[model samples]
Each structure stands twice: as structure tokens, then as C-alpha cells.
Target chain A: GAGVSQSPSNKVTEKGKDVELRCDPISGHTALYWYRQSLGQGLEFLIYFQGNSAPDKSGLPSDRFSAERTGGSVSTLTIQRTQQEDSAVYLCASSANRGRVLHFGNGTRLTVT
Target chain B: AQRVTQPEKLLSVFKGAPVELKCNYSYSGSPELFWYVQYSRQRLQLLLRHISRESIKGFTADLNKGETSFHLKKPFAQEEDSAMYYCALSDTGANSKLTFGKGITLSVRP
Candidate 1:
């Protein structure tokens, strides 16, 4: 891809429903990251993935939030039983080398009603 | 735990005036600091990093480990400089994920 791309730029869903967000990192980039920005938390780290190794899931708010990167190319973040608090701009970024610099996508605006 | 703190939520300055955005961090060991800027309706991009020690768009940031701060300074503020700025830190590791601050919004008035 030319740059980092995220799917479903904007999504509105009813509470308690499930939603999935997609992120397509830059080609040949190995490091990928997911972050959430809400009015309360400001910007919070959700997850981290590097190549094929195990992902750093330390930042996931709960078990309901899970992400997987397939073939080290694309990623999907699934939120089960969505809550209003989960509504925020979900940003995805990737770095070609390491975490030195990151290229960010336009971001997906998730709104839970 | 690693954390970046930008105490000021907002900063206001007139065009052609000197401007400074403060950023402080807390980490046990050495830290690599960076400054990122996001213009209105634009994706976030890196403005400068401490390691490179280079100036971009007349903005420079020095890593002052003594105070654990990386303050971004520009001699003359431009209207285009009005944007959201974030302070981030990363450690020396393969994963090297960034821990970002709450971010500060800079408004430059003409």
C-alpha cells in the first residue's frame, strides 16, 4: 500500500453489538501498533505487534478487545459486546524499521450508541 | 513504568512570537524522546526526535536528561505551527513501542 490504511473510516453501532476494525500497514513494515483516543483517556495504547512473534497485548483494556496480524501484513481489531466507553478514534500506525518513526493512517472513528 | 507528561493542555501565541512547548518524562533508564505534530484534518507526523538532534521547520528539541525534559522551541511562530503536539518516549529494545503524553494544542493567532 502507498501508506498505512484503515478500513471503516467511520462506524456507528448499537451498544452490546460486536464490531471489527481493520488496519493495513505499509508494505514491508514489520512493526504495527493500535491506539485508542477518547475524551477521558486522551490517547491510550491498546496493542503492539512486530513481525510474526507474539504480540504485546499488554495495552488491551479488557479481554473483549483482541487483535491479530495475519501474514505480518494486515490486522483486525475485534471488540465484543461494545460499550459506550469504547467510542473513540481508533488509530493504526506502522514503522518500517523500529519504533523510531511511525506512519499513521487516517484512523477509524468508532461511535457506539 | 514509562510515561510522557505535557502539563499544558493548550498554548496560545501570536504570530512571529517565540513559542515553547514543554514536555517531561519519567523512565527508569535512558529514554529516546520524540516530538510529533498533527495539523488540522491531517495525519500525525514526526516533527523531530532527540536522537537526531536536528531542527525541522525552525523547531528544535534538546533532550535534557538532567531535567528529564524535551522542550520544543521555535523562534518565530507561524500560523501553520498551530496544531496538536505530542511528546513520546521509547526504550532500547526490538519492540520499542512509544509511550505518548496527553498532547498539547498550540494555537498561533495572527
Candidate 2:
């Protein structure tokens, strides 16, 4: 079976530009999450979506960061006015409803120059 | 707020030697602990969870509520075990969003 899939394996952009990272969760997985992986910073939770209810944006570092999951399957994390501080590997994960295990994608590495 | 801590950044050991990766966490309520591993060029994957109490790839972790620790251990190390390990915590609530620690790198030399 296919695991979580993320697009644009690597992206380099100039500061102040907007970037959108996409994620395709495995079929039937209802929960989707985005995380930022930085050197020495570990995996920082960005946002989470569970079913159709309100999304958990508590982990978003700032208002510049936002994400939306359409049809409860595909998700896109959008960063407005990217900053060098935002450079990191963005990871997407999914799990079944109430399932404890999280299947992760290879992640998209974003670098702001 | 819940927090996971992997105090050490790196550990190096020879093959066949015992390995222990330390992990400690802090949370207000009862939390679930998990160990995630990432091999070179591979995506992160679940290695084990405390609730399962099952060993995978010769690795096992025991959750100690009194100490707030869920350290991963292996009796004998293998060169193939070299990779990054992350400790994560999930609250018992419905959300189950995980809080991960700064991962530690294990280098198992042949």
C-alpha cells in the first residue's frame, strides 16, 4: 500500500515568496498532520486535521503559516512571505481515526535563500 | 503542555554491544509514548509504542510513569541500526497529536 506522499521533494525560494507544500494521505486515513523538522529543533508540530471538525492550528509558529485539507484527504501547507527561519524539512503524516500509528511521508525540504 | 526530551544528540557503539537511547517526557495527564526511527534516505516510521509492549527489530522500550521516561533499548547493536531516533508523546484525548523530542543519532559501527 502507498504511504503518505509529499510533492516537490525539495524547493528553494527567495525570501518573501510564498510556497505551497502538498500532501496526499493514504486512502482511508482520516487524520492529517504537518510538522517542521529543523536541525537541533526536532519535529515541530505545525497543524493537524481530524475529519471535518475544526483543525488544530495551535502549533503554527505564526499567522504566516496556514494549511487546508480538502475532501479530508489531500492537504496543502501554505507559507506566506517565507523567511529563512522557516527553512526546514516539512513532513506530512496520516493515521486512521483513533489509530495510534502515524504513517509519514518523505517530506519536502524547503530552503529560503 | 506536554514535552519529550532526548537529552543526548548522538551515540556511537560497536556492533554486538548493548545500546540504550534515553528518552524522558513531561505531561500533565496520562500520555502515550512512542519511538520513531529514520534510516538514511528513508522516511520516518514508527518503531514501537509503549502500549503495545512488543519489541521490533530487537528494540524495546519500557514506560515508567514514576520516572516519566520511555527509553529505547537493544541487547546487541547492529550496524544496520544506525539512524535517527525520535521520542514522541501523545495525550490520551481524542486529538492524539504528537509532541516529539529533539531526535538522537545512533551510530553502530561494524
Candidate 3:
């Protein structure tokens, strides 16, 4: 892909429902990251994947938030039993390598009603 | 804990005026700082980094370790420079994950 791609640009789900956001990182990129941006807030780091190593999940806000990256290319973020506080933009980014510049996607705006 | 802090939430300046967006961070080890900008309806993009010490689109930032700050500055602001700016910090290691601050909104008015 020319740039990072995120699916379901906008999602409206009821509370307690499950939602999944997908990200397709730039081709051959070795690092991927997930972030959340609430209204009037900064980007919150959720998770990171580098090559084949264990993912850093320290940033996940709660047990309901989880993510998986398959084959180090595509990634999915799943939110179970979503709450009203989950209504925000979920952003995905990728860098050529660690410590390099990040390229971000448009992001998925989830609205928990 | 590694953290970035952007104090001002909304900043409005006339075009051609000098502009500065304040940022501060707290980290125990060496820090890698960057400024990311998001224009209206556009994806967030890298504006500059303290490590590169390079200016992009007339913007520059210098890391002040003593003050624990990395402020973004421009000699003369332009209307095109109006955007949401974020300050980020990376820990010292191969798996350098970024921690971002609450962004500041810069509105360069004509």
C-alpha cells in the first residue's frame, strides 16, 4: 500500500457490543503501532509490534481491549463489551523501523451509543 | 514513566507573527522527541524531530534536557501552518515505542 490503511472509517456500535478495527501497514514496514485519540486529547499508545518479537501490550487500557498482528503485516484491534468511553478515534501507524518516523492512517472513528 | 506534556490546548496567532508551542517531557533515560502535525481532514504527519535538528516548513524544535522541554517554534507563522500539533517521546532502545502528549491546536489567522 502507498500508506497505512485502516478499515471501517466510521463505526457506530451499541454499548456491550464488540467491534473490530483493522490496519494494513505499509508494505515491508517492520514496525506497527495502535493508538487511540479521544476528542480534545492526545494520541494514547495502545500496543506495538516489531518484527516477530512479543508485542508490547502495556498500553492497553483494559482487559476488553486486545490486538493481534498476523505475519507482521496486517493487524486487528478488538474491543469486547464496548463502553461509552470507547467512543473515539482509533489510529494505526507504521514505521520503517524502531526510532524512525511514523506514518499514520486516517483512523477509525468508533461511536459507542 | 515517560510522558510528554503540551500545555496550551488552543493557540491563535496572526499570520507572519512569531509562533511557539510549548512542550515538556519526563523520562529517566535519553529521550527522542518529535513533532507531528495534522492538518484539517488530513492524516497526522511528522513535522520535525529534535534528533534530526532540521527545520521543516519553517518550523524547528530544540530539545532542552535541563528544562525537560522540546518546544516547536517558527520565525513567522503562516496560515497553512494552522493544525493540531503533537509532541511525542521515544524511550532509549531498539523497541522504541512512542508516548504522545495532548496536542495543541495552532490557528494561524490572516
Q: How much of the true A–B contact set does each candidate keep?
A: 0.57, 0.68, 0.82
Q: What is the TM-score of chain B alone in each candidate?
A: 0.97, 0.98, 0.97
Q: Write the per-residue lDDT of candidate 2 for residues B13-107, one digit (tens) a residue.
A: 99999999999999989898999999999999999999999999999999999999999999999999999999999998977799999999999
Candidate 1 has an lDDT of 0.90
For model 2, the superposed segments whose C-alpha errors exceed 4 Å read none
Better of 1 and 2 by DockQ: 2
Ranking by lDDT: 2, 3, 1
Least accurate stretch of 10 residues (summed lDDT) in model 1 chain B?
B90-99
lDDT of 3 by residue, A1-113 (tens): 48999999999999999999999999998899999999777899889989645458898999999888889799999999999999999999999988569999999999999
lDDT of 1 by residue, A34-113 (tens): 98977535568888889855457889999999999999989999999999989999999998877779889989999999
iRMSD of all candidate structures:
1.4, 1.5, 1.3
Model 1 stretches astray by more than 4 angstroms: none
Residue-wise lDDT of candidate 1 within B1-110, one digit each (tens)? Answer: 99999999999999999999999999997789999888999988889999899999999999999999999999999999999999999887766788999999999999
**Interface residue Cα RMSD of candidate 2 after superposition:** 1.5
User: How well docked is model 2, in DockQ terms?
Assistant: 0.73
Instruction: Report model 3's interface C-alpha RMSD after superposition on the true interface residues.
Output: 1.3
